[model samples]
Target: MAEETDHESKTEAATERRVREAIEKGDIPFSREAPVFASTLGLLIALALFARGQASQLARDFAPLLDDPRGFALETGGDAMLLLSRVALAAGRFLLPILLILAVCSLTASLLQNLPRFVLDRIQPKWSRVSPMAGLSRIFGTSGQVEFLKSLVKFLSVSVVALLLLRSERTRAVNAMFVDPSQLPELILTVSIRLVSAVAIATIVIVAGDLVWARLRWQRSLRMSRQDIKDEHKQTEGDPSVKARLRSLAQDRARNRMLANVDRATVVIANPTHFAVALRYEPSENPAPLVLAKGQDLIALRIRAIAEEKGIAVIEDKPLARSLYDAVQVDQTIPAEFYRAVAQILFFLFARAR
Candidate 1:
């Protein structure tokens, strides 16, 4: 029975840890579109990088095959197949490397922007997931409204760009039909440039919309209420009362340990109302002074009582006492700026001790 209880306790602890990790992750679901977009962009970049070399190699490899059908068949299939296969393999050797590097880069880029967190609850079998009414509601949701606006903006931007590009290319577009055949390439080049520029403009608009969406989505994900955090802590760390008791016990023990050092202190500085700080200086062992104990209010009063019972000197300097209590913590030396004032107090104490 004891062994079974221990096992159950361990299982409960594991469940709580898992819940805490999920809460810290902000419960964001993975979006498939971002990864797909990243991979596509990476592939485009990879293709652009090798465009010239790959285009030239392809031309060289295919030009001879295009000229003779028998030679093409023989090179591709028959007696010359081995040599043709080796050539083809050699020509395509860099393709896999390019693809793998781009894929990894795309995955890394996507992850760096926002790590996809899987939440089973989001995709659970519910009426909402499959309902037409639910779908319509989402389509009319704030995010859905933004999506509609973005689509409208994209359409308008693309139409404007297309119209501008067409207008700019109108003269060359018309001349292409009547001009000499030698001018055909120039007209084609002009139209291609216009189309590419228009497409580039459209891409920029889409990217801007994506940036806005990413920011908004992250903001929404990071929102958490005070009660939600409290509930999450309860779920993750067990009851609030138990944790509070543990913390209180720990603090009490710490205070006792600090009071135990009261007899060892060289001096005690008091605010005479709500603050007490004790310092211990040993010239033989410590180069600088150290705080032996410090406390405020009830703890402060307790420290003062312990000091009185131990016959430790109690010095009252309102500003110096307050500053020491605020700025320097227990077991730390006072700062250099207060050295002169501290020296005066120490000198008086040493003279009185003598």
Candidate 2:
């Protein structure tokens, strides 16, 4: 029990990936009451529109048997079968529209709750589902208790609604009791319509409430653990620490390569201590001076030390060194905006060499 509690505590709000995976597995929030409500409402509407017509058609179909029972007798068995088939076909035709309405309502309710998606996993057999212990636990669990309470509430509420509706029409019922038997059917139909309509309306309200509650419960169930969220992030964006380490290694390799290129540069310009930029110029091979390497602070100190060791000219030009380091990249030709400044520096160096 303590382990179970700890596991439950680890889970928090579900991540998008978790929710999407659950959807793919056919795990979705749904309220069974939604379809029942839709079907009941549709049935009530269908009855209101076609009940009288259906009753008249039924009376017509059965009237022959009632008026002249001897006429149904036939010499051949096939004739009797044909007569029965015709009656059955007529009944089916009459009820087809109502059945269609109920079917459409059920489908619409299902679609609204969770849009259609084909997932064969939902239909696949699972041994755990068939386990007797699991079945018993499900029947005696928290969900079962909630279902039982809901059933009891529905029964009591419908009973109260029915009693109220019947009491309201008691006077008419009493009057109808004394009327001709033929009038009794009409009176009963009227009372039934009122009772059913009230019940459907009440059920719809209950179903709406249940749908909200069910959705909240489903969301809670999908909550994920902190570790699960981190794992998903690593899968999608990679582990942050690993990425940082790789970046540091890449920077080190680039810096080593840059230091090696300092030997090929014609001059190393420095801000004395804070900045360093090594420039290479070959008038025959290139039109403008190229930045061979650049670095700042500690790296700048290392660049100056390497230049001194290699016997390369190290010029301390604060503004030029700072501008080169900020604006130019290694292996890139100096920009046109810095052309005059770079040209003067190169010319001065050539004169000094001559």
Best by lDDT: 2
Instruction: Tell me how candidate 1 scores on lDDT.
Output: 0.70
User: TM-score, each model?
Assistant: 0.42, 0.86
lDDT of residue 166 for candidate 2 = 92
Candidate 2: tens digits of C-alpha lDDT, residues 8-59: 8766789888889999989899998889888887788777887667756766
* Model 1 / residue 224 / CA error / Å: 1.9
Model 1 deviation from native, Cα RMSD in Å: 13.2
| Highest-scoring model, TM-score | 2
Off by over 4 Å in 1: 1-112, 115-127, 178-190, 202-206, 244-354
How does residue 308 of candidate 2 score in lDDT?
A: 93
lDDT of 1 by residue, 63-129 (tens): 5554554664453356587657857775676466567756886688667766666766756788987
Worst 10 residues of 1 by lDDT: 7-16
